[model samples]
Target: MMRITDHPVLGPLENKEVTIQFNGVDYIGLENESIAATLLANGIRTLRYSEKERKPRGIYCGIGHCYECRVTVNGERSVRACITPVKDQMIVESQGFQS
Candidate 1:
């Protein structure tokens, strides 16, 4: 559960539950949640495979410093999911080398 289920500092994040699309698949998430958080809560890791090495990666730093959580948002490339708020109708896709 992303180890946030009973976090010591953040506690439980507040947000209205919502649905969003990830890679053409609809998934339930919180509106106030970061895209990476939502994906982690839903047991989604490996946000993208590295272009060269093709290594599996998920959220490395929750502060968005690392690009491990980057994903496409509404046709934009390299959107950091660790900081981007989840929004309704947002289109998120895992980026590939050719993308």
Candidate 2:
């Protein structure tokens, strides 16, 4: 039941879905949806760990302003997943101090 099997407000999430790779692992996501939303929908939390303090962080504002939702996209650093649309074959990786 990783998927949003049933939601009270949304009432069974259904939309155009796509597959994307996260840290080399494939996952099902919705097209045209924000990366953060897709990840959250699929039960992915703790987007990144703080470099200095190693503090866990995830979606806070749900907007693009916050950098907490930042993740590496196709080898690019500090890409905000909250604003980025899910693209097919896109490679996403968790932001961490060490690989």
Candidate 3:
């Protein structure tokens, strides 16, 4: 959803296919795109859950203004997927409240 295919000024963005893992499953994503954007392009929207309510949260305020898109990246918690670039073979896991 966030990929810039064609812009009036930037024209186009060039990206190559990349491999990334999400929740133990490997998926194909574009290089240099944000983790949240890649996940959204793959139709996976739930990035994390509310700390208390356990409600599914995703790319809300995608510009990094909110924590709704936070997820675990490479065993690190509280990583904001919406702004974090997706690295090839990067590991991403949905974050849920510790219960």
Candidate 4:
């Protein structure tokens, strides 16, 4: 993702890079960064789809207020990616009926 190398006040981010599995594909992300950020960095903006219209949905509101960024983590469903931290070997799946 577009991580800030040095936050003017917080200094450099030392979070180690970790590999995460999204939709069966491997992607690199910071250990502590949000899953949503990691996916967005990898050009994966469509997190899910609208139930009725079958429209693609991504990050909205960004603070967990909206459930547009929902996804399946490991074996858990309805997990919010915007708030979940990425970890090594974490398996994330896009929530929808498409695949």
Per-residue accuracy of model 4 over 8-99 as CA lDDT, tens digit each: 33344457989999988999987767788889889899998878888898999766779899999998998988877788999999877674
Model 3, residue 12: distance off in Å is 7.0
What residue runs in model 4 are displaced by over 4 Å at the alpha carbon?
4-14
lDDT of model 2 at position 76: 94
Candidate 1, 91: how far from true, in Å? 1.0
Question: Deviation in angstroms for 14 in model 3?
Answer: 3.4
Q: Is candidate 1 or candidate 4 better by TM-score?
A: 4
Clashing pairs counted in every model = 0, 0, 0, 0
Which ranges in model 2 have alpha carbons more than 4 Å from their true place?
A: 1-14, 97-99
Give the best candidate by lDDT.
4
What pairs collide in candidate 2? none
TM-score of each: 0.82, 0.80, 0.84, 0.85
Would you give me the overall lDDT of model 2?
0.76
CA error at residue 43 for candidate 2, angstroms:
0.6
Give all candidates' CA lDDT scores: 0.77, 0.76, 0.80, 0.82
* Candidate 1 clashing pairs, residues 3+ apart or interchain: none
lDDT at residue 10 of model 4 (Cα atoms): 32
Comparison by lDDT, 3 against 4, better one = 4
Candidate 1, residue 48: lDDT: 82
Global fold similarity of model 2 (TM-score): 0.80
Report the Cα lDDT for candidate 1. Answer: 0.77
Screening candidate 4 with a backbone cut-off below 3 angstroms (N, C-alpha, C), the clashing residue pairs are none
